[model samples]
Target: MRAPGKLVPVVLLVLALVGCTNMPPPPLVTTPPSKPPPTKPAKTSEVVIGVDGITGGYNPHTVADQSAVTTALGALLLPSVFRPAADGTPQMDRTLMRSATVTKYQPYTVTYELRGDASWSDGPPIAAEDFLYLWEQMRRAPGVIDSAGYRLIDNITARDAGKVVEVTFDKPYPGWRSLFNGLLPAHLLKDAPGGWDAALEDGFPATGGPFAVSRLDQERGEIQLERNERYWEQPAALEKVVFRRADQVGVVDALRRGNDQLALLRTDSVGLSLLGTLGNTVAVHTVPRSATATVLLRPVGEDMSDARVRRAISALLDRDALVATGTRGGPGSTLRAEAQVLSPTAPGYRPTRPGGVSSGQPELAQAEAALQQAGYTRGAGIWMRDGRPLSLVIAAPAERESYVSMARELQRQLVNAGIQAKVETPSADQLFTESLASVPTGQRTTGAVHLAVVPRPVGGDPATVLASNFGCLQGESAVAGAQPTNPVGFCDASVQPTIEAALSGAVPVAETLTTIEPVLWREALTVPLFQEADSLAVRPELTGVDVGRAPSGPFDTAVAWRRAPN
Candidate 1:
């Protein structure tokens, strides 16, 4: 037994030695330490907002580009000398402006001192050139929101290495704070492809606010904005903000799925119903827009060329009835617009409609009288002027529900008045930039758009609105050899001086409106119907969402928006 066991141990030992020699003794048999569990990627700090649709040409100063998205983008990316208060008064923006004061009375000079650190995102200081660019463009460009305040500027001189701006006006402008708002990047826009006419048609070249546009994907219907780290003021709280385009149903679905944190949509019956489905998860705010639904009778068209005929049409389409029809189930249902110069939501708004004017009941008699005075006779239940029937084309933006609804209502009213009107749905761009714009001096406008149901853009300044909606075209004054075109295609030479007086502070705005509004009403160019409204839906996760003080909707304080802890 000793001899066999000794032999077996000897055999095992030999095999083990052979294995150790080949495999390096089992690599010392040490246990490898475990790595810390993979860290979760830091969640992106972002807020996604659902919007109706994303269209380009984001210049907030132009009537063709007037939109809530344009206003919101302006508030987020552009710099302004003044921002509107809760009461719609222009308040100095301390972040970009140091002091803005009327330094002289003889020449009516306003001096603006900009913060030294204020600069655009692309390394250019926010300077007097920006002011001069806006002034020149507003004064010369057609289809601008308002140019009356800018047209008063006699000269603009720079000081303090372009940080201080000395603007001398031909007359004092009480609404000076409204000027130079949403300042453009002059260095980039001045020599760009389209200059003032086409500037910002795509996206901002440089930003002067708390957020900068990082991406504008039209195909994806998304606009991505990133915090402007170079901003002189406090940076935006969130790292990113996204505007996603969605229809009414898509908006509600996005909110339900927690995909969208906020939404600013045009108010409609269907949209309101859909948003109601979100229930307690979202807070719905009825945000009145800084615009009014108005019916414009363009004189350039043959049917509306006669002042009496225009008056007839204006009287036939009842304002109260249009308001009720256009604003049903919306926030503006109770906000009736009666002033052509200022919306009911605007500061210092006053009813400009002359007293003693009954509702549509009395207006029918007035319409009949005016139509007879214009030599229009009823034939086959349609008004006949010359040998042609008074069959006019009514145009409205297809995208806006209120405008389209109001247009249909207007058509009904005209039809009941023995007038024929055919409704046309065109994109807003075609309607504002082409159809409603004034024709060139030696040219004629080619369209059947006699009546337009459109949004009259209102602002903080009453005088600016007066001139913007009715001012005569000033051709080639700011730039040499440029053609002039009116915004509304209606101008009264007699009232032009009075409008200028209001814009220049020569006449008190309240007094000037009293005089000018009656003239506008008699001209029958525009009839105010109701205040426009927007609906904002916000999720509970959002902390700083508010209907901001600015007319730019709920994104005015977007820089301070934050998400609650998960």
Candidate 2:
């Protein structure tokens, strides 16, 4: 239920580069300062970048590329064919391509004219052949992200001595600019292993992105990047940027002390505290993030599995209460409730009911009757189902303070209803794998996963969201349950046609939602959670810090963002 999606690899690329050294270091964020908040901000000096360790390989094919990082990196080089226009439409930047045109009929082809002046960071002129190479590689590459986009292109033809690139799609495939989501080093990858299924020795040799990785400290989990002076856009104002791995609290403290310029705040106390104290700071820039967090009411657990019991539990859960008391709606008032995976910023956004936190569906009496139907009796202290105590384990990433805290609150509320609830939290890594992993498929992980506090990127449209992340979903609904354990689970039987229609750039928003709404209402795999606000504490001198990409992603012209007195 999110956009500008970053597919976290659960089964894809698992191993960190063991022997790949000449390989480009884990992609690092090039900053006004690449290093962590130094003892103090430099008057005019190199920018240091701070980031978490990207252990599972930074390859784009792998779901774990954490694409926002790559998008930021790509900002310096190739521009997306469709950039977010001021009018809320994704428009083609056309910096590399002189012009792109698509005819409505036959093969559903799209042809692009390359700007003769455009060149790779290495100085090789960009030709239509470069687009061919990218498409071919996308088709053949095993681990590439967004297979759907690649699947659409039936054939690639290069003409005019490889200066004209024409692509033929299988059907009336639309979504004209989705191809721009990809960033390529066309000159080098042109001859490498077609689809980059595995780590190529030097697949990322050419320089084009805003920053080219310069140093990597695997042992210490540190990375350094240098700006691409050859970048097509204005070269980065700063000389260097560095990233160091640090936890949430440490990152927050660094930001406060001016040691860390900015942080990609994950779900943790740091974000919470920042929300708590936002008013006291310069300004905290928050936005409607394109991700969802949900709770799957399981009826088959020890005390669950009984539909009646599950329904009772579902009815009793005052969703409004949770929206009011739990998550971001706490004291700081940072959380925003939403419907569907589309964030407010995503195109065609409409607020709807989340999960089964049913609106206008009160259930004190309904819960009592359902419990009785499940043969559950409300005793003095606990709930009784067949003379046994009704209890459930609210699984969550135990290591995440934010989750654990929310779990405790949930447990308390559940206790009042005579159900004993406990939190089972795991480490951050396990948390992701567990969320992506499913319930038992006949004793195997069936992807019956209930919920997670995952953050989704929010810069693009819903079509972009489906192509990037959020195809996998939870429960036995038409779309999600139709397929067992969707790797990119975003199943909405009705949504498929709209997606198909939207891809062709035809379906209107009202029509697309008309089809998508029923399936969503039927299976609440995704619940509306609190919205994220734009919260950034900046010095008055720091001008041009575009708040375009927040939560975590590239900002418009982040590198050009000056530290003032320019």
Candidate 3:
């Protein structure tokens, strides 16, 4: 495995929280209410979700660690603007948005209205200017951080009071609506010290969510999230949503040992299997996270340096077989075989074939032909570069037993197909460093880091991976902030203009994807992998925890869910 962000992350906050819109405040708590107005009572479920490790840090705009504090903390802050609805979808939550109207296009602008009851946990109105301040702060942020990712937008404009906010992009970027999840406490930070990443550790300001910062325990385990009765929307479900910090591995353990009820995070299956073994009393919801997994493919030995050869190797991959092994737990595992950089469940995914690959049939003839066209000849047992054996290292998820097996099989398969292959196993940290070092090619860097493989992030948004990893991007890209998406080291003379156009907010998602296909096909960076099936194991006793295939993604409506009777 590789380390996280060895190539400098693209503005760290890739996982910022998106706030809810148009929610009617809780029914006024008057004396026994007015003459029996029949109403459904608010839900009350207190199930703790566990994080696997001690959070490295918790600054949304800048913190280095990816703790729950950071992920859940954004609820306290707010995304610059809430998009009301996700990309290419109808607004499902009408109660949350004051109004969903795209006032203008040509200049690429959208505005949202705040409900009159919209107020922070501290009872302050959530002004539209708060978003404006956030935009300005992001534009002017210094040092290296993720907020810069949005700052790269030269044409964004958020004007007006706490009710009206607008943004303008230089050109049409179809995914603009998806980026509406930036958060800011404009009134509090209007004249604060440091940016979001540098907020005072001892004391953070008021937030607009159901929970306020009641106890800031920087040295302890988590930020205890007491439900804010003053929040504008329906009050949060749990009285206390303890944003507990633990290791990813520990998450499963915490849940099974009865230490916690539910958990979310990339975790090992070891601890989870124990729950099943112990059987039913405790419910374990094993949902496949819509997160990306990168497999390492080293370019050492093989002439995979030739884009065609790499593309050819990408073709013969048996994604179904791969998934069978890796996600063998099936419904028991949350891993899915994705079709592109985005998950199969992601929106805008129009699969051309069963899983999007061209004739997944292992074509020995085709592989030979492609290599021949690239100026290479088949030698004794394997393909060669210059009288030397052609081989490269492939890194994968070693935490799973299947990873080791896959690494061995990958080496064997590549060899059988005429390219010599080897496996160079590395820890997660090493994996990141090695993958980054190998992609530029003949940086000879990792010496043998080759095929970094796995299902991509399935957030239904390409930016999930695009905003964070652009490995194929060479030299400077017009898309600033962080660019780790290009793993095949795809370099285009016109990549800058292309990315800019796609992100300009004017193009529709379908149109933008149409534009990116040919370019990606030419680069051979991310060849279409297979569709993934997430494994999930939920004890029947725990009700309301919904996990379904979504037009936008997996596990979408778990928002207002709850655990059944104990």
Q: Candidate 3 — what's its lDDT?
A: 0.49
Off by over 4 Å in 1: 1-44, 301-303, 318-328, 355-363, 398-405, 423-427, 439-448, 473-486
The candidate with the higher lDDT, 1 or 2, is 1
Tens-digit lDDT string for candidate 2 (433-479): 34544342212223343334333333444553453443322223344
Model 1: lowest-lDDT 10 consecutive positions: 475-484
Model 1 TM-score (2 dp): 0.85
* Tens-digit lDDT track of model 3 for 111-199: 67666676666667776666566667644443112232344444534334446556664444445444445355667767777545445
Q: Write the per-residue lDDT of candidate 1 for residues 74-123, one digit (tens) a residue.
A: 99999999998766778898999999999999999999999999999999
**Model 1 misses residue 198 by how many Å?**
2.7
Comparing 1 with 3 on TM-score, the higher-scoring candidate is 1
Per-candidate local distance difference test = 0.80, 0.52, 0.49
Model 1 Cα RMSD, 1 decimal: 5.8
lDDT of 1 at 106: 93
Among all candidates shown, the one with the greatest lDDT: 1
